[model samples]
Target chain A: MDLSTLSLGQYTFVQNAFSFGLAVMAAATLFLWFSRSHVAPAYRMAITISGLVTAIAAYHYLQIMLSWEAAFSAVGGTLEVTGYPFNQAYRYVDWLLTVPLLLVELILVMRLSKSETVSKSVTLGGAAALMIVLGYPGEVSEDAGTRFTFWVLSMIPFIYIVYQLVVGLKGSISKQPENVRGLINGAATLVVVSWLFYPLVYLFPLIGLTGGAAVTAVEVGYTIADIVAKAVFGILILTIAMRKSEAEGNS
Target chain B: MDLSTLSLGQYTFVQNAFSFGLAVMAAATLFLWFSRSHVAPAYRMAITISGLVTAIAAYHYLQIMLSWEAAFSAVGGTLEVTGYPFNQAYRYVDWLLTVPLLLVELILVMRLSKSETVSKSVTLGGAAALMIVLGYPGEVSEDAGTRFTFWVLSMIPFIYIVYQLVVGLKGSISKQPENVRGLINGAATLVVVSWLFYPLVYLFPLIGLTGGAAVTAVEVGYTIADIVAKAVFGILILTIAMRKSEAEGNS
Candidate 1:
């Protein structure tokens, strides 16, 4: 499992894959942004946000791959020097960047469809501000304590998203939009599942589950799940955006 | 790791939780069906499908909990077992039931907006059918050969999903909705990440990654992911359904 032992060719391959993925993601974001004006205004915002979030995630992953190589080089081909901070930084950056975007996308979709009662523009503006406040600092440090602090700060927005989803689901259900309720429920499920990992990561050390491959596996598993959540929610938001535009065109 | 020594109270707690979850799911289904006429026809169908799928998953989890108790009792109050066929059955059932619904939900959303091209529907339909076929026999046995077959078959729908998503993403980028493209990309990412476990689970025997807590953890992790996926996608479908209805109402 000593990743540092990887040959130069293998290291280059990993680095290339990471960079290429990020590049494609950036291209996708720009493409989406340019096309936004052709669609409904609300959906335009949703796609824009989705694109930005995807770019952020791609950047974070790229950083992880680069750091992996750097840490390996630092150890001169040894895996024992503890690049754990790099790993932690990757996870924190991921959560801070993607989760709030997901929330905003949902709200924008609801608002575009006129299903949301609140002034969505104002709410979304507030959420964006909160995301910057929470996420920016999270990406600044790989220190365990600082990362943990940012994670707690990040939870404030996470909780707000959950509340919005619950209320949205209820409102949609009241209007007999059972399908929307179902979608919100699904997105909320991921939020809850992703959050479940946080306490485990932070609290497991207290219960002595904080070492070895088990801990590593937990971290990896959570990271993968978070990625899946982003991907799934991102698509859901995109679908909503498209539907909103089509409706506008028809009208 | 022998689960057989569990006191009556622990078993009862699991049993009750399973039952309560199932009952709530059942009620949700009935309510969904009953509310159909009050909603738009397209969304009505989506809601029905989503509700049914969720109910099925809840039932499978309940069955797993009950079977775990049965296995414990059969083995003279010990949790250790030679194999966990019942657990495997539940897992396959959960996948077989949900993956198709997810595909169908996506198609349904497009259909609601009357934006789906015929070829896209055909492709999605074919994938949905394959998921059911692969998933059905997966629940039959937990033998290594059977498990391998199940995993291979399951991959068909997953791969198809990835393909459809790629196509959809490209299409959205070129001419259609930006949000739709975003959603497809997101779903494609999840499909890839979730299926990463298939090879791991199937190949672990060859690599000697099997046994005790490791095996249990993998199985449980997959199950949780499955549940989370179903819940999230189910909600997404609901969102699309609601948005479509709102559009119709406004029109």
Candidate 2:
């Protein structure tokens, strides 16, 4: 059956799913906001970070809807672009948002261990830089000029972040609470999982693993990894929030 | 672009990815085992459940390798049959493993709150039954007749588990320790996130979302969600394990 000939009911169903996803995001955002004031300062920051991500995801979905219109117009009389700028704006905004979130989370975890202030700032800064390099340009762009330049520039910080995490984990291994240690280790595993596919994705094309569907499969795999990372990271932050409050009450 | 024409190197790379995945599963199993002796008896059971899941995943990977000869032969044969039996077996085993792990984690959290036994067992048993109903026949046949019958049967248990969780949450909402409560809530959310797409996946075909690729996309989406659930649940289990150990030490 031709997808293009989708019945009205089918179209409505897909549209409704997308709409429901948007509503869920909005609700999550509000929930984060409401809980923000009650949490410790560090957790409040994490909630703020989560709120930003939810907002970006909502915007991304809206932009996807606009891209549909752009595609339709591109096929007809005159080409019209409805959401390119908004889409492109969020591309970098998403990276900026995630980078700080990752860095802040790492720092907060370290601080919970009562690590040296100087070392924590340096480590957090390094992680932030790494996130910028790896996550920049987003993963969807096909423009060679943009993709290649950003890809090259992004590796510097990515390597640095990996180095810092390894060093930090080694140094702080003895000091961390068991739960925090487990979370850090799990998050590190997820980061490695995400990065392991990067070369296979971007570099494989240059080495001839570039068939159309194969490339599509790689992208889908990366997206799946990203989603897993986000979900795990969200749980980690929630744990931090709850644990911090427990500690406070006992004190 | 025919996949069959791929040289030895490409095939080896793909095989290596699967092997790497298997290795990760092995590591996860080891982690689960180590966790078992560190938590309370109730929480230890949860960790054991996770270990059981890891074992199933390991077995699934081994099955894939064992079925490789048939899989490769089928690729070259006139019949379009892939070694989908092995694939389906892995998928169902993974789901069954996940459902129990999720329920056990929730039960451990609830146990921390009120020490209620009968209600927790009923809820967990209901969840296990639902998982078995959905998972068993879903793995056995791809034939429409079997698929339709199993899908309907699966829904009965799925709905029941959801109802159980909702009621359980309401009952324990005010009494739970903040940390344990957060963990339970997060676990419930993860379960919802993992299963949210089920209806989309099963009902879509009835609504005319056919074709191999479309079906594969939905399957992959579910697989990714499963990974996310495992990662988040792993963190939650670790949190409880650590707290249980700490409480034991204090006593």
Candidate 3:
């Protein structure tokens, strides 16, 4: 919400977070791509989509790193704004594209009956997009009232996604091979927990946090959550796909 | 080797070339990754490595882009040097890494006997690396003697690789499934022609070409060669893999 001079330590913290995000997302994308043939044909598209999500994330992370460098110059003891506004919109743009695909990839890998897959994909994908779109205005707003309003608006879709993951996906996940049921449940939990971290980070400025502290908090926080949500979640999806492929004697 | 003010048209030509290189590499990486599952498991590594080669190229192209933008300022009718050096090393570094893997991936997908695969991969991979390493001296050196000396040395491994692709691989190509034999032959031819483009481009500075025209010529020329070598060559690998998979009844 406001610019503050950053101590070198504070600037490096966010810089490392974004650079690490790029590396992890890129590595995960390739690993998923290379491992795609290990899954059954029915679930291969899910693995492909997982790779797509991470590749998209990797591209954004690269842009984020550039924007971070452009916005701050830590020349001596402190990091000062270079008057190039940090393109924080890269994060929202990434989320808008990937969040829906994340939901779709999970649904696809479950190998749900066609009608159910199509229905759930549409519903959850729409909710994810809505959540991101509603959150952006709030994310960029400086006024506490406007920010809080969009936060509340955004939470509506967030809760819906959570509900779908916890309740609606329960039966489908149950229908997964017995060996992967626990992993599936863990993945669903991961999605909820990691996704939840974003809103908490979003509220940092609204709380007492401000200036470098608030900016660093949100940057580092959101970067960590994104890595977990995409990289970790993609790994879980790949593992489940492999295990299910084996369970089905397709491996 | 010397800086000159560039007309806006000259600057945009090179800038667009680097940007296009970045986009093409990124797209090729994703395409190869998503198509990996379409091939039989035995051939999937070739497809996976194709993704990797393109991905590595993409990363360097991103860096090259940053350096290109940083090295020039075209605020008016002319583009002027910005005191930052254009990171031409990124291109050589990329070539060093991907060139070896490009050879190895081809050897791998041929499904030679284990011993033959190992032998060819080692020899060809080593040759590719040496070619790039040898070429870099000439690539960066402005001295005519130094550049010409390295050029001749680099061509040693280049000719070796082309020989292996043509002579040594003839039997291997003939042994391949009939459905993919034509494709294999074409791939070998593609490698030779594309790689030949590099040395010609490398000679640009050695010739009468100078200043921005020389820079633009080499940048655009090398960018085209790289795309054809990695992206087009990679597509051939994937097509061969898919055809071989189908012929083997493994698809």
Candidate 4:
């Protein structure tokens, strides 16, 4: 269950997944930051928040990757795992930070009133962070029942987050320019759909894939979801903000 | 290596990667086909080509995934890998078909003169397909020298693709409305940068990571590039085409 026990393949998959995610987060952070000049001033805050989300994720993924490397080095290349440990807590720490900022970026781009934005962002962001913190225990649990329990508990906040996005934000989304409304809705849809992968990934072990298959599925699934949730979704936000910025500039 | 030797991690990774690519491609194809009401008639051809690129890749990825499944079924939980053969040619085949179409999609979006569009698309598309065909032999080569030689050959065409996008297409891109021009340029840059990963991935084996590390880097790297080149870039193209479509409607 530790570094020495992992096959070279497992190690490589985990290592590459984190490294690639880190690279993407870093690149997206830079892109979001530099794109400010091309967007309207009103949309700058959203852009900043998007950059902050990826920047934070990049730092945390680096920590996770380094932790993995340290664990791997402790055991060398032997396949008999004894006590080498990796710190998966880094991922929880990352989601705790990035997930909230993700919601905030969405809210800011919506251009809601100050009070409405504050209330909505705080509520949704809190739920997002809570979902991550709550899911961690489940992810590391050895007992399937314990894992499922934490998963169900995490779903409470996840459902609320989805509700807030799909229903709670509907009015604001509908009010956007017709062309952009589809994109805003699409962004929200992406959040809901991509996050669903987390729960599915959590169930990999329950279905009796406790070996490399389960691990591979979980790591690869999460990697794909993370890219979609963070980078791809970030681009969607940029598009929305850019269109809005241009509209304002022209008018 | 054949199917028998592939680790569960490898099987799972390949299966998941192809499946996910298929889903993204299918979704994009549906989106393009259904969104005709939202785009100008002139832009629809570009959108359709974007859809075609994904559609072709999707079909190929499905074949790749099915081949993996068949290979897995043959082994039936025997950890020792044997003579289960899975064809990687599926990738080369897919790329050969889709890469050219990718360039054509870009050329189409420019709304250049009929003769100019046909000439540029044919030239660029041919170069893109040749790049893939030339690289395939290197990918499967045993000797580092042979791989490098083929890589250099591939790069010749890659360099030409970049030149075409940057210099050859400059006039058409520059003539776009200011805002859309930025996106069009960004799209061109996305092609250049994302394609750069292909070469770096090629160097994985030369760097002495010839085992799981090499395989991991190549697969994960290509998956990331494919997403950017096809899905992410397709979205950018859609954004540009949509904006131009809207401008036309308004004017």
**Cα TM-score per model:** 0.43, 0.49, 0.55, 0.57
C-alpha local distance difference test of each model: 0.54, 0.53, 0.85, 0.76
Best by lDDT: 3
Off by over 4 Å in 2: A1-150, A153-251, B1-21, B37-42, B64-70, B73-86, B112-115, B134-146, B208-212, B244-251
Instruction: Give the CAPRI class of candidate 1.
Output: incorrect
TM-score of chain B of 1: 0.66
Most TM-score-accurate candidate: 4
The prediction achieving the highest DockQ against the true structure is: 3
Residue by residue across A1-251, what tens digits does model 4's lDDT show?
A: 32334677776887799899999988998898788667776677677667767766776677667656755543565444322245455556567657887898889898998789879987998899789878977876778899999999999999999998889898888888886898999999999999898788778778776665566556667777988998888889999999987777731
Residue-wise C-alpha lDDT for candidate 2, range B1-251, written one tens digit per residue:
11343333233223333433343354455556645555666567667766666567656655654553244332221223343333445556566655665676666645643546556756676666575667466445646677677777777777777776766566765475554666666667777667767655766555566554454455445544544566446646666565655655631
lDDT of each residue in B80-165, candidate 1, tens digit only: 43344335456566665666666665555555235553455567767865765775564354465775687688777767766766
lDDT of 3 by residue, B1-251 (tens): 56565667877888899899999999999999889778888888788888888988888888778777877777865667765456576677678668988887788789999789879988999999899889877866768999999999999999999999999899888888888888889988999999889888788777778777777878888899999999999999998888888988998
Model 4 C-alpha lDDT per residue in residues B128-239, reported as the tens digit of each score: 9889989999988878899899999999999999998889888888888886999999999999999898888787777776654455456656766887898778878887
lDDT of model 3, residue A59? 98
Q: After superposition, how far is residue A206 of candidate 4 from its true place, in Å?
A: 11
Ten-residue segment with the worst summed lDDT in candidate 2 chain B? B72-81
